[model samples]
Structures are given as C-alpha cells and as structure tokens.
Target: MSIQITTLDSGLRVASEFMPNIETVALGVWFDVGTRNELPKQNGIAHLLEHMLFKGTSRRTALQISEEIENVGGHTNAYTSRDLTAYYARVMHQDTELAIDLLADLIQNSTFDATELEREKQVIIQEINLSRDTPDDIIFDYMQMAAYGNQPLGMSILGKPEVIAKISGADLKKYAGIHYCAPKTVIAVAGRVDHAQLLDWVKKYFGQLSPVSDAPIPPSVYKPENILINKDSEQAHLSLALPACGGKDPDYYAYSIYATLLGGGSSSRLFQEVREKRGLAYTVSAFLSNVDDTGLLGIYVGTAPGEVAKLAEVLREQLVDSSRNIKKAELDRAKQQLKAGMLMALEQPFSRAENTAQHLLTFGRVLSVAELIEKIDNVTPADIHRIVGKMISAKPALAGIGPKKSMKVWEKFELT
Candidate 1:
C-alpha cells in the first residue's frame, strides 16, 4: 500500500508500489524514446527494435526466452508507442528474479541476427497490411498525419513497408544504443515485493548501461488539416481533432473530464445523442491524448455513408451545447467515473506498473491516488465550459475512410 522510488548511480529510475495482499508482481523496463526519436528515414525503427530484441539475446535463444518465462507460469509482453517502449512481465512473487533477468538480457545482450531481422521486417509489413485493412484502426493513422503533418509524432508506429524493408540489423543496434541508456529508462515494479531486494536485482543486471546518453527528439508541431481515404467499406469511419494541453499542463485533468462527459461511455453525450436517440452510428466515442508538448481532444464515429452530413451537424451542435449547458450532475458523474477507473487500476499490477512508469516520465514523480482524486473532484462546470469553449475555437482536423461519394460530404463538414 506504499510507493518507493530510487535513482541508481547509473541514472536509472527504479519505482515500485507495494501491495501487501497480492501474490504476483509485474515489472518492466520502459524507455522514453520511441517513434518521435527516429529520423524520418527510420520511421518504424523503434517498433522493429522491440521485435528484434525478443528474437534472441546473447545468453538465450528466442525459444529459450519464451520457454523460461512460461515454464515458471509467467508471461512477458512488450509494446512500442509514439512516446515510449515497454517490455514487461507478470509472474508469481517467487519468480521475480527470473523476470528481471530476462528483461535485462533483452535490453543489454540482444544479438540481432541478420536472418531474424529480415524475417521480422516481413512480419511487420504484414502487421502494417493488417492495420490498413482495419478501417477504424487505419483512420486514426490518417488523422495523425493530418494533425501533425509529416513529422515524427504524426507518423505511424508500425512504419511504412518500404521504409521498414530498408532497415537492417545494424539499424536496430544503433537505435538501441542511442535510446536504451540509463538516463531515459525506468525499471518499474508493482505488487508484493521488497523495494530493497528489487534495487539490488536491478543494479546487478542493469549496471552496465551508460549513465549519460543524449536524447535528441524533434519537436512536434500540430497543424490541423483534412484527410480522406476512399474505400469500398460499408461504413464511414470519421475522426475529428482539436489541439489541447500537454500532460503536465494545469488543465489536463479538466480536459480529461471534458472528454469523458462528451463521449467516454454509453451514458455520455455523443453515445446517447448519436447512437441512442438518432441511431446514426454504431460506434461513437471521444478521447483525450496528451503527448510531450501538445495533445488533442478527438471524437470518432462509424456510420452509414448517407448519414455523414447528419452526423456532422449533430456533432457541431453537441460541441457547442456542452460549453453552455453542462450541469453539475453531469460534472459529478464524470468525476466519479474518473475516480473509479483510477482506483480500479490500483488493483491491477500491470496497469499500476504502466501508469507508474508513465507518470514518472511525464511528471518526474508518481501521483498519489489522493492527489489524483482531488484534481478530478476540483474540475468544476466552469472548467468544463472553459475547456470546451477553447477546444471549439480551434479549427478541427477531420479524417475519414469510406465511399468516394462521401468524400464531398466530409469535405464540406466544418466544426470551427
């Protein structure tokens, strides 16, 4: 029921949250460099490195890495995002050492074989193809491009097939050497654990990392524009976005509450108005995203091609209405929802570890549940109104995938 943080001499941040009742622990090595750290030619190198690391390490073969974890009744997984990359595992408390060693090996001793690197490129190309086939998924990629132009932050993490095809084993090693150093990395653990023992384990295995490594990431610039993709799909997947605050901004919590009340769940405004009352779309939701220096408040919907115009009209009205007509009841409901979700995550070791790593990287400290709840509770109706009003004032970037005829429908839709 307590959290402890320590900085090793190598500049690595080891953060752990102790839960006395749990029998399992979750731990991970999180690196702050991701897609944004890549050069334009090396678009998907971060994700490619993630796959290559698991292919094999100097101490163990690919099969050995998987077998060792599964044999102990534990599992390991990793993901690469726009801002961070994580390799984590869940295991019984007694197997914590094995998990830590396996993670350490992947980062410090990986031997990116040439044969494996070539195979992984094809695998990622297939992944890219699969994503393209998914309309709802790919629309977001298009929306990102429209939002931030051709910059690193706006690029898809999976990368383009042509770009990935040219990346070699040397590229993976070079990228890792640059970004996987002590200064930008965090070793986060949660659940039943001893903080002192955890630090000892980290020092033994991760002591080799260089304490100083420069992270030169290009700044992200938000440029709102429109994008349209014509496909023979049955429904139109549409996304709209407006600039918002970064994760450290004072208004971050207020923006979170604003998005929740807008379309976080079935009871929220977008779901009730678009799906229940008018029956215009099957899936509709709003999300808030906060990156390093910028963020977005976005709304997404999938509807029949013929209903695009009506959907746009209703969205405009709802966006405007939320600013002026938000009631105390709605604000209270959103606050409770945020608080409940935050508290529930505390019981999940994996979620707790993930949030802990992210909080440290973003805010340079872990936020207490009390502090988070107070922030959520302090968001007044006026805060919501102010956030909504500011969001609506900016021109929105619109992205869609559907029939060609619907292109004109989306082109004419405006929400500024």
Candidate 2:
C-alpha cells in the first residue's frame, strides 16, 4: 500500500504506512534538528536534548515512561544523528494511539530539568571518553575532521568533552525551542496503522506548535585533509575518504552500487583482495555518507599494525582498478545485493517508518517500492565507471591511528 501523508495547519507532517498482515506498529517523531543545526559552540545540545526527553515530561517521570511502555510490551528509544533526531517505539497494533501520544508528550512537554541536565552532561562526557578509548570508533571522527575541517558537517555527533561539559539546561531549552517547531518535525508510523487516526493524533498533539523563523544553513565545503595519529595500539585503524554525490544528487544510486561492489561484504572486491586472499585484515568495508548537499566515499580497515602498509596499497589499487576493470558480473551482483537489502528493509516496520519520516524531510515524499527498485536497476556499468572515476579523481582524505612506524607508512598511500 502507498504511504499516506498529511501536513497539519501548523506545518507538522504526519506520515504512515499501513501493513495489515502484522499486529505490531512502529512509530516515531523525527526532527530535522541535529548536530549541524546547532551553533558553533552548542555542538552536543541536540544529542543532549534527545537524552533529556526520556528523563522526564510534564506528566510522566522517566521511570513511569519506561514502566508504562514495558507494561504494554512495547519498547521505546531515541537516537541523534548528523541530520536528524528520532524517538521511536514499537508497540502492539492496539496501542498506536498511546505511542503517538507518548511521543507527543516527550517532544512538546519536556521541561529539561536542571538536575537531569547535569547528570546527562556527565553521562555524555563519559560517552565521549568511551568513543576516544575505542580506536576504530574515534578514527572515524578524526577522518571526518580531516574531510571537512571544523565545520558542523565534519564535527562528531557526540560533540567534544569540553563542549559537552559547558552545555547547560538553558542551552538545551533554547536550542529545542528554535529547532523543534512544527515546520521541522515529522511523525511517521508503519504497520497495522490507520492513516486517519495517525493524522488525528498529530493534529491533537502537535497542531499548536509554532514554526520558528531561523535562517537557513549554507552548504558546507568539502576540503581535502590528511591526518596520521601516532598512538599505542595493537591494531591500526584507517579511514580514507573522497568526495562523492550527496543524498539528493543524481549520481547517488550509481555511487552506492560502486561502493557495494568495492567492499560491501565477503564477496566484494576489497574483502576478497584485502582479507580473504591476502588475509591482511579481519574487518574491511566501504561506506557512503550523504547529507543534504554533501557526501563522502570512504573505506575503513582494521588490521595489525604491521599490515597497515600492505592493506593501504591494496585499497588504493582496488579503488583505482574498480573505475575501469569492473566487470558486468560484479556490477550485476552488487545490484542484486543492493536491491535485496532495500526490499528486506522495507519488510521491517521500523525501517519503513524511519524511511518515511526521513524521506519526507529529505525529498518531501517517500519513494515507493517500485520507485526505489527502478532507480537501483537503472544504474549501469557505465554509470558506475563514470561515478567511480569522478569520485576518486579528487585528492583523498586519510585518517589513521597506530604506532608511529605504521602511521609513517599510512602517509604514503596518497595519490599525490
């Protein structure tokens, strides 16, 4: 069935996909405000606010919120990302109204208590420290810094420890007021849902939200950078990135196909070349991150310090080779893999609901199952070749963490 959407008079979007076969529903409130929406100094406010929502609301304490949901056999959680923050719940079909009302209460009635804010501040500080202690996790942050410099686009979603410490309750409330308005919010529900009821709940709970008048954010530049971190570590962590197509760009599908063929799994070129055949690394994969107007084509590999040099060479070689040497069979397999993954994701209510909300925010509408498949099918070997060449021709950005000797070798992978 088609996903239904309604925009309340207040500008909040209500979207729903009804799957009749199941008796469970996944629903969420998705907001466009994220780390990038913050001021330079308020890096972690978006994420902190996400945590604060669960701590308390006007009518329910944090424990009551959890107890009520659990008593009904439902699970509720939230996450903050670079572009959006989502609070979602999976509940039995009969509890759809309850889910939407709960989400509404969290988003609109949260008081951002001062004491809760202090405790969450320390918790986020520890979260930051934990990421730093994990080499592979922290290397991505360093890679992002190298790729886009200090812009919000490049900054860590978790924010810096120092900045997190200084983030006060006033900061959280003020940021939320400006960004969590009707114009910036979406409520998406999938599975055993009624579009009419969802719309009604939205109007009842969110119809009063006033739209904020904030200035639009300008596009972020993708500047190339390279950083080699010397640390004592058992394994070397490496991330190499090149500029690529954005989320809404025409080449998005082609770039995705090429990335999958490169290192998506055990059957991929990078895995076969770097891990299976040579046994250089246990973990190696390619990733594509696409924001509103910018994107990155990147690879991450974790291996023993001694094997960093060899893995780097193989990665560079495979990337260069893929632009021209990609065969029809490899392209076909990648297409199938991507198509299957897409179809499987649609079968899940959470993925469907999340996609609906995110798509409405990103493209103003959700792509139908046929629409997504057709786009993925339209990608040809020539398209892959063209985008691969275009993406890799730019100077690559590199981030690595290892002993000094391994990092010295890491610096040698640059094309220039």
Candidate 3:
C-alpha cells in the first residue's frame, strides 16, 4: 500500500492512502490523549466528551450534525479507549472535504451546553448499568482492575456514575483545552484520496489548533493480583491475565502469535482441550491488550459454575504444555492467520484509515504491510516458547464473576 504523511505548521500530522478503485473515503482525526490522561476524579470525562462533541457545536445543533452527514448518505461516529479517542466518518469521495470540516467544527467549536451535559450523563449512566449487568462484558473490567489495580490504566473508560454526574461543561472544556492540541493529534484518510488537496484542506481547517503538547500521561504500572465478584449468573466468567510487552516492544509480534495459537480459534489448544475434549467451557479465547508502556496477555473462559476450578487447571496445563512443545505446524498457522487478517483489512477503507492513524501515533510512522508480515514470519517456535515461558512464569491476575459457590472456587484457586 502507498501511504503519504505530512506534518502541518501546527504540528498536526496528516496521512492518506489513495485507493483509486474504491468510491468512498474513510477519514478521521485521532487524539493521543484518552482515559490515561485523566486524573482520578475525571475518570470518564473523555468518553463523555466524545458524546457531548456530537451533541452540538457553535455553528450547528446536534440534529443538524447528524442530518448533514446522513443527507449525503454518509455515517459518523466516535469512541474512547485507554490511550486514544477518535472521531471518524465515511462518505463518498466527493464529500471528503465536508467530513473534514465537520470534524474540525466538533473539536474547535463544541459549546458543551449544560442541558446537553445533564442529559448525556444519564445516557452514559444507563450504558454503565447495562455493562454491569453483562457478565462476559464486566469480567474484562475486573480483569483490568486485577492487573493494574487503581491506576489510570486499570480505570474503566465508562467511568463511574457518581463521577459522571459530577462532571460539568466547564470541566470538559478545561480537559479539552489541555489535551486537544495539535501536537497530540493525527488526521488520516484512505480510499480515493488526493494527497495535495487533502493536505491543503487539513491546513485550512486545523491550522488554528494550538501547538501545545498534551498533559503528561500517568504511569500505567502493572500490579498483578486476584479479584472476585459475586453475581447470580448461571455461567461462571473467568478472566486470567499475565503482564506482557507493550506495543513498542520487539516481542509484540511474538506475543500476538502466542495468543493466537493458544486460544484464538476452534482449532486452538484451549478451545480443543477445554471445550471440545473436556467440555469444561462453552467459551474460551485468548487476547492481547497493549498500550505505549505495558500490556496484558489474557485468557477468558465461561463455563458451568461447577467446572470453573477445573477450567483454571486446564488453562494452566495447556499453557505449560504449549511452552514446552509448540509445534512448527501451529506456529505457521498462527502467522498465516495474522497475515490474512492484515491483508483483509487492506480491502476496507475504514480499517486502513484507523490503522494508519494508530500506527502514526504509536510508532511515528506507518508500517508497511511487508514490514508487518516479515515481523510475524520471523517468529520461531523458540520465540513462542519464550513468550509463553515469560507469561506462565509471571504471577497472573485472576478475575471471576458467578454464583457464590463458583466465586468460592476462584478464591481458593491459583493459576500458577
């Protein structure tokens, strides 16, 4: 893929790829600051700000914002994560300029009306309530808390209801002013984009953004421990996490392959051993979460309450056995899966735009498809063993939610 990157006078970076065959363009502005940039009291403000920005701007009402985009048969949305927040749109190539203008208006001109603020708080509070009631969903948050404790990294992006209610328009404005500067932002576009014209549009629209750097991000120190939550669910939900390398670590690719081979699909060790063979769990999968400084390699399992302890034992055995005897065939399969995923993403404009933006923020450059595949290809059986060895040797953070009896089993269980 051909990608071009430019830095505006204001320090905002712009990158684009021209997909001449596609009729639509996917574009977005991404900020380096997110939940990790907030203080303890400001836990959920980043997400609240995401909703409020869509509520209204100085030049348009909230209805007008959605109306204009939809009138053109386009779509827009935003999301907040641990280390990034993004506002994005997909529109016909001819409407790319309009998308850019609308996004600019959002960051620069949002009014943050008090009435809108109160209404949106209730909306987010409902969202929090919904998440709490979902066993599989809330278990990850408990896992995060178990891994990172009370630090910014461990805090939920949704924040708490009491804190959300306390946040005011002025507080949002202050946070935005401190974190939404040009030096901490990236604008990316993919599919039928014109580099020169796009660069001109970015300069004209985002030139006024302050060049100041964002507030210092808090340290995301990993502190491993076990945590349990009592609930009345029929199935026991368990999340096991071991601290691992971050996005920038040389071992990132290796760790990703390790996760994929361990429990990523039906043919994976955990799925075959825990589900197909032993009938211990209905759902078993492994995943990786990475930020700038730290990461988590996690396995999630859902099973009958009576089988939760056996599930943990199976997980430990699989991990240990895989480390000692990871096969060449499985390693090759994992690499192929990862490479196919990257290639498939290349066909979608939205993925290209989002991945370009993230790569620029994380690595200060767009990694070529070739470079990425080569990294995955270089991972050997020894590398898989190395990552697995590191993971099982470290203390794992265990988080469980289920009936009282299931919770009791987890309380007495240790992964190592």
Report backbone clashes per prediction: 0, 0, 0
List residue ranges in candidate 3 displaced over 4 A.
Answer: none
Give the per-residue Cα lDDT of candidate 3 at 114: 96
TM-score of 2: 0.97
Q: What is each predicted model's overall lDDT from 0 to 1?
A: 0.90, 0.86, 0.90
Q: How do all the candidates rank in terms of lDDT, highest first?
A: 3, 1, 2
Q: Write the per-residue lDDT of candidate 1 for residues 365-386, one digit (tens) a residue.
A: 9998889999998888888889
Residue pairs with backbone overlap in model 2: none
Where does the lowest 10-residue lDDT sum fall in candidate 3? 407-416
Candidate 3 versus the native: TM-score?
0.98
In candidate 3, what are the lDDT values of residues 285-334, reduced to their tens digit?
99998897789999999999999878878887888888779998988998
lDDT of 2: 0.86
Q: Point out where model 2 deviates above 4 Å.
A: none
All candidates' TM-scores?
A: 0.98, 0.97, 0.98
Range of the 10 consecutive residues with the lowest summed lDDT in candidate 2: 206-215
Q: Encode model 2's per-residue lDDT on 1-416: one tens digit a residue.
A: 67888887778888888898999999998888687776668788888889999989999998989988888999999999888899999999998888878888888888788888889999999999999899889988888888988788888899877888888877777787888888888889999988997787777777546666464755678897888889988899999889987889878988888889998878999999998999999999998887878888889999999998788789878887777788989888998999999889888999999989988988998877788888988988878878878877888888999899998888878653
| Residue 11 Cα positional deviation in candidate 2, in Å, after optimal superposition | 1.3
* Candidate 1 similarity to native, TM-score: 0.98
